[model samples]
Target: MQEKALSPTVSTEIITLTINGTSKQLEVEVWTSLLDLLREPLDLTGTKKGCDHGQCGACTILLDGKRINSCLTLAVMHDGSELTTIEGLAQDGELHPVQQAFIDHDAFQCGYCTPGQICSTIGLINEGKAKTLDDIRDLMSGNICRCGAYTNIVKVVQEALERNHKA
Candidate 1:
């Protein structure tokens, strides 16, 4: 009689990502979600994990300047991609325009969804697809704020769009 191994060796891959304007090379398990990699080893806890299934949009992040649910993607899948988390939105002690807008408009409650909402709004602005109020609502519907801050959130986004156009 002999003991047998129940599983094979774990697979891992090294990835380079430009996060928050910094380049990092990290070795992560193949199956590790981007959300896990961010919150765990990178210690970036601002990206929430409300619903790991990607339905809640709590883990939304800017991957290559586009918004994507970090929980829905694998860390290995985004090699060579540039990512921006909430932590990176502020620079040199000054918050990004959208971040400042959120604060000015008080667009958050409980603050759980603020990070995702802000990131999504930035992506939306970058896409240049949201033109009107309804367009903003439709484009931002993916990110939910259980605190019911939709009104102020919309205002913040609208202001951000205007600011971008004026820039």
Candidate 2:
């Protein structure tokens, strides 16, 4: 097989986005995913790099108040959008309800997936699509926790849902 020479492509664009309540402006390659945007220059590593293919939901983040797999979309695509990562979910040195609920319920192990879990939980709650344990499981099916802590995770979700509903 003859090796074909590939054309080199280099294009970088400047984008501004609200990340974790901070406005960030950065120049990046067009192919950079939102996950890389957070992890690279922005240095927000709370969003995990699991699977890196949008399957595990480890890179889940809130884009414009909705949850999305950050690994699936390009950074330039979300210019001027609001993004909330695991780090952004907290307020005034206090954990977000979902984070607190997860801690109170011991909903994590190994901790690789906790960040994603937390972000996903917040997103799920904001979505208001889960009204029951089953609904939570079905809706949160994308975030894979190898620790098999689904029971505790579900409990946290249930608590957060009830609490958020009251508010």
Q: Mind giving the per-residue lDDT tens digits that candidate 2 earns over 32-99? A: 99999899888899888999998898898889988899999999998899999998878999888788
Query: In model 2, what are the clashing residue pairs, if there are any?
Result: none
Each candidate's TM vs. the true structure? 0.95, 0.93
Q: lDDT tens digits, residues 24-139, model 1?
A: 99999999999999999999999999989978788999999999999999999989999999999998999999998998999998999999999999999989999999999999
Candidate 2, residue 90: CA error in Å?
1.5
Worst 10 residues of 1 by lDDT: 1-10
Q: What is the C-alpha lDDT of each candidate?
A: 0.94, 0.89
The clash count of every prediction, one per candidate, is 0, 0
Clashing pairs in 1: none
Best of the candidates, lDDT: 1
